[model samples]
Target: AQSVAQPEDQVNVAEGNPLTVKCTYSVSGNPYLFWYVQYPNRGLQFLLKYITGDNLVKGSYGFEAEFNKSQTSFHLKKPSALVSDSALYFCAVSQRGTNAGKSTFGDGTTLTVKP
Candidate 1:
């Protein structure tokens, strides 16, 4: 079974400061990782993913993530955070080419960016 973890339940950041939402995974085989963001009353929106090549993967809305095989981590990052960036973030993982669209998701991390 594949499992993902977001160590922090809540992340508080200042507007314009660098922000990071940590994620780590455990899988039997090579993992396909994904990050998602959700706003109030809204469904999750894909943020980024790590499948093959380039450890640094960029995604929508100035967000990026680094896949560290050695650490088994795929933490989400943004150089500068905006107040609008405040949202719930999720980290997910699944065995490559096995689960298809199915994945194990983290409990979620609430990001709050204050002015």
Candidate 2:
């Protein structure tokens, strides 16, 4: 089984400041980690993923995430935040080789970027 956790329910940041949203996961085997953003009344949008490559992976809208095997973490980061970046972020994980493509997701973290 695979699971994901976002310790923080909300993250507040100022525009032009760096921001990070924490996430942790557990899986039986190799894992596929993903980050998604959901705007108001819209479906989730893919941001980044960490399948099997470098520890650090970049993603859309100037966002990035680093996969830490030792810590079992995949925290999302942005160098400079923007007010428009405010949204609900989710962390998802799925065990590799799983028959179903279903992914376990975190409760979600609401990001509020103040201008």
Candidate 3:
């Protein structure tokens, strides 16, 4: 079985500061990792993904993540935080040969950026 864990319930950051949302995962084989963001009353939007190659993957809205195979972790990072960037973040994973549409998502972490 494949699953993801987000240890933090909420992350608070000041505007212009760096922000990070942690995530860890387990899968039967090589994993397909992804990050998504959701705004109030909106659908989930794709942020970035790590399919293969390049441990460091960049995504929408100036966000990026590092894929660590040994640690089985994929942590989302942003160089500078913005109030607009505050939203619900999710980490998900699926096995290489499984249905991509069926990826397991974490509980989700809410990011709050203060002015």
Candidate whose lDDT is highest = 3
Give residue 44's lDDT in candidate 1 (0 to 100). Answer: 97
C-alpha lDDT values of all predictions: 0.94, 0.95, 0.97
Worst 10 residues of 1 by lDDT: 94-103
* lDDT (Cα, tens digit) per residue for candidate 2, span 1-115: 5789999999999999999999999998778999999999999999999989799999999999999998999999999999999999999998888754688999999999999
Q: Can you write out model 1's per-residue Cα lDDT over 1-115, one digit (the tens) per residue?
A: 7888899999999999999999999998788999999999999999989989999999999999999999999999999999999999999998977856789999999999999
* Preferred candidate (TM-score higher): 1 or 3: 3
* Clash count, one per candidate: 0, 0, 0
- Segments of candidate 3 deviating more than 4 angstroms: none
12 Cα displacement, candidate 2 (Å): 0.3
| Alpha-carbon runs more than 4 Å astray in model 1 | none
- CA lDDT for candidate 2: 0.95
Error of 3 at 112 (Å): 0.2
